[model samples]
Target chain A: AQSVTQLDSHVSVSEGTPVLLRCNYSSSYSPSLFWYVQHPNKGLQLLLKYTSAATLVKGINGFEAEFKKSETSFHLTKPSAHMSDAAEYFCVVSDRAGGSQGNLIFGKGTKLSVKP
Target chain B: EPEVTQTPSHQVTQMGQEVILRCVPISNHLYFYWYRQILGQKVEFLVSFYNNEISEKSEIFDDQFSVERPDGSNFTLKIRSTKLEDSAMYFCASSLWGTSQETQYFGPGTRLLVL
Candidate 1:
């Protein structure tokens, strides 16, 4: 079984400050991880993904995440926060298993709030 | 850039009524998928389709739930008898290939409200 746990339900950061959203996972096999962002009334936009290639994966909109196998973590980070960066973030995990092929296991999600 | 699209941005139906949700995936993509997110819950994968057949499905995809690629450009999901618990946002997604390495583009989603 594969599952992801987002450490924070909500995170608030001041504008221009650094931002971090923590996520952890449990998987039996080598897992693929992804970070997706969703704005209000919008679709899930892919921020970044890790497929056993690069440990430090850079994504769109100045966001990035590091895959740490030993720590069982894949936390998203941003050097600076912008107003538009406030959105719902989801950490997802995927691995080959019965009836789970090509399916992603999504976390409960973290609601990010940017303070001006 | 090409992207996936879905119909009926919002739909309201009574319980026990049937509903059909439609999607148009990115043209060059070979895999299609359907996912749903109940209010205040994590997004859940319902089914994955490829080569005109179901490749994978979760436990939530029961006998009442059926999916089809009715045309070259359209994929559809049908719920025979919707329940109050069926109210959720349904998302359609597509990927160039049904591999873990590929990124799946998603549509805006359809908000279903089962009364």
Candidate 2:
């Protein structure tokens, strides 16, 4: 079984400041991690995914995340926060130990609030 | 970009009533899934359908819940005798057959409000 734990339920950041959202995961094998963002009234959008390729993965909208094997973490970051970045983010992981065909497990989700 | 589309974005039903949520997955996709998220809760996987049958299902996917692909284009989730606890946002997603290793495209979701 695979599980993801998001450290924060809500995070507030000022526009133009650096933003970081922490996430940790437990998997039986090399995991495939993903970060998804959901804007108000919109479907979940893929921000980034770590598929055993590169440790540092860059995504759209100036967002990126680093997958650390030792820490079992995949934390999302951005150089600066924008008002439009305010949304709910979910950390997800799949059971690669089960051959990557396993269903995805989603974290409780963290709400990002950007204040101008 | 091809998208997974869901119908009846919002549905209001009384307890014990049956409701069916519809979805049209992307063309050429061979895998379909249904997940639900209660308000302020983590998304829970209900079932995964492939090759016209369920590949996997969770405990929440009891006999009360069912899925079907009546046509090659439409996939539907039916809840028989919905309870108040059934109110939540249900998401339908799909991915190509061999692309199970990739991310699945999700729909905007159908918000079912069981009164």
Error of 2 at B6 (Å): 0.9
**Ten consecutive residues with minimal summed lDDT in candidate 1 chain A?**
A94-103
| Model 1: docking quality category | medium
- In model 1, residue pairs whose N, Cα or C atoms come closer than 3 Å (at least 3 residues apart or on different chains), thus clashing, are none
In model 1, how large is the Cα lDDT of residue A5? Answer: 97
Q: After superposition, how far is residue A20 of candidate 1 from its true place, in Å?
A: 0.4
- Model 1: what is its DockQ? 0.55
Worst 10 residues of 2 chain A by lDDT: A94-103
All candidates: DockQ: 0.55, 0.55
Off by over 4 Å in 2: A98-100, B98-100
lDDT by residue (B41-106, candidate 1, tens digit) is 999999999999999898999999999999899999999999999999999999887877678899
TM-score of each: 0.96, 0.96
TM-score of chain B of each: 0.99, 0.96
**Candidate 1 chain B: worst 10 consecutive residues by lDDT?**
B95-104
Mind giving the per-residue lDDT tens digits that candidate 2 earns over A38-116? 8887788889998888999999899999999999999999999999999999998875542445577899999999999
